[model samples]
Target: MKRVLFLFLLIGFISKAQVKPTIQKDDIVRIETTLASDKMEGRQIFTTGVDSASAFIEKEFSKVGLTYYKGLKNYRQEFVVRNASANNVIGILPGKSKPNEYVVFSSHYDHLGKEENGKDKVYNGANDDASGTTAVIALANYFKELNNNERTIIFVCFTGEEEGGFGSKFFSESINPDDVIAMFNIEMIGTESKWHKNSAYITGFEKSNFGTILQNNLKGSKFRFYEDPYLEENLFYRSDNATLAAYGVPAHTISTSKMDSEPNYHQLSDEVSTLDFDNMTEIIKAIAISSESIVNGKDTPTRVQKIR
Candidate 1:
């Protein structure tokens, strides 16, 4: 009788595992390579490259069965920055029960366009943000497949982040901050963290209990999320999450880049070849798993303190 019960449990576990949508390294590679390729021309804001990249993202969202946000005809959330046209590709997966409450996943898609000095003029920006954008796409596909989110999920690829975060600033003004439950702004996960393998850090870990909620969700997993090591840099307010965070939303940026020693940082050498696709795949998977509770409305992160 004991053996029968053990077998039944094992079968159930295997079935659940089979049904899970695993984020694959190949998917990461495909998305990152295309976005970081020379043809993209670095995806700089106000450049043809950025427009092409936004179009590509829109196609991917449609392919994944994501629809436009409410009252929008298409996925491109167009805006202007310094009189230059900019776009934020947005897709929505409405929740089953609580469609008004939102859990946002964002990544900046813009990068340095071209350098004048070097023969390799293109700044690929694979590690700076292409990796994060790839993760956003993969996460969208995963959630679409699972079809189990209880709170609305918003996937956004922002432009003009490198040019002073105009995209996010505009977006923040357009939304009601109270409806936003949490924001996961993924950035620079192409390489492993300085802490060790399968680890990443969240900026402004002390600003709220958001990191705690994430860590608690990841209990028993090998992946570890830690506090930002370079607190002195005030990294929490430096990224695209800052705008929403100012309005008291629990927004944070997740990354694994070693700011002090990262070789490729903003240079033209930051290409897809420089990234570790395996580590990136693991990071994306960890985010998807840890965010399950928030997406399902089982957990809500503490609000960040409103900045003056």
Candidate 2:
């Protein structure tokens, strides 16, 4: 009887030690709402709205205990594109072993600021990219708490994606492409994919084995990551991932928006209410889990063929 009682106590202790994660649906909703609100003025580059968005991202990074990247005093990495000044908010969670290698999570925070002729002037980009930005924060917090990564994880929220991927283009020039193991660029995950339930898509899925690795990690799970359905649209080159992919980095964008049917794309009607927070949470969690092998340095995805 004493042995049985001790066994029960041991199980109880183990369960207690496994604390629940803080990245909940409510947290996602709150962050998305704030980032996509009218108060942000659509987060356009060179606008006050974009500045406010960057400041909020910095605060969120600080709250989650993510350290600023090396050679920087703060989270904001400011750069210039033509005459316009832009910043990418970056934070780092150093690895337990292979600190020199990097696995990056990126999302652009900028959107079309506002429209002149529309009756609804504010272009709140709730689904366009606020959802992606929220995932970056959520993943950062999740990884920080778990503390199990083997390769350094960099979380970056870029500013000039709306203006022809300028932010990522500038950022790609700053880092040595060889050190970057992979980049998962999250975009427009606020809605369900054309697959409609429990699935998302990856652009440029055939360029490398990146999607295969992610799907392999999610074996036996309901959540699925598939190839982009809108191949004819040439989505692979459209988003922030293109810059690094051009340099042979295994970078791709994950998204749930149906390109042909997504009604809210670049419209004034894209608000927080239109998003499905539960689905968003599931996608973010799946990203965290699917990235485990890469983060641990156990799986190295094949590099993309550099485009001329």
Candidate 3:
């Protein structure tokens, strides 16, 4: 009977192992372009454009058959930004076994709005964050299809990353920090890194062993995750991952943007035309594959040192 159980588990593992990148470039392009389109008006917070972006993301979650986050009636995790209202679009896939443990996949969707000038009023922000949001959505779809995670997966597209990390701050406070096993915060991966294609850098890499575990998983793949090269820029605490990292979660930002020279960084030319969809698709797949063991509860990374 024990032998039969071992064989059963081995077969299941092989089946999961053999699964390739199911998320295609076409699907990624469609999602990225739509989010970065001029029609979305740069997805600024507390505006109609950002509202539309959230709706589109919620629709995708619905299509993936994801459940609402805990204590929410829908996918929108709403909160007040002073007098105005803003929200984070969140969805969850409950674990098959370790339901209490959580693995978070996050990216901020907010970006600069239209400027006063008629010359390219839309910032587009295709690479700044629309690409990252697209990745989160794609990962959600891929993991949902697998349906074997032992850790509950939370996919969130944060708001107000440009103004501040208000969305992530609220989210971190809403849940117990101890319950969160890891946080994969993807940002600005539309372009290839300085190391070139199929490569990314993780911020706060040395603070925890998260990057090492991820690298260990991609033993045979061409893709690579490197330590953040622009340490002087202090990227580890810049994005939505900051708040969670402060609480001692193994939260890290995965990015390819070159801080010293990204030509389109916050410029009017940050559009889909500048991105490499094929490479972006590969980055998303690498994230999905590298994170599988953690989701399956086979690996646990060291926690970040609590700053707060």
* Global lDDT of each candidate: 0.92, 0.93, 0.95
The all-Cα superposition gives candidate 1 an RMSD in Å to the true structure of 3.4
Per-residue C-alpha lDDT of model 2 across residues 120-143, encoded as one tens digit per residue: 888899998999999999999999
Clashes of 2: 0
lDDT (Cα, 0-100) at 95 in candidate 3: 96
Give stretches of model 2 more than 4 Å off.
1-22
Lowest lDDT sum, 10 consecutive residues, model 3, at: 15-24
lDDT of 1 by residue, 18-68 (tens): 487789888889999999998889999999998889989999999999989
Structural similarity to truth (TM-score) of each candidate: 0.94, 0.95, 0.94
* Candidate that beats the other on lDDT, 2 or 3, i.e. the better one: 3
Alpha carbon deviation, residue 280, candidate 1 (Å): 0.6
**Candidate number of the best lDDT:** 3
- Model 2 deviation from native, Cα RMSD in Å: 2.0
Quote model 2's TM-score. 0.95
**Pick by TM-score: which candidate is best?**
2
Poorest 10 consecutive residues of model 2 by lDDT? 15-24
Give candidate 1 misplaced runs (Cα > 4 Å). Answer: 1-18
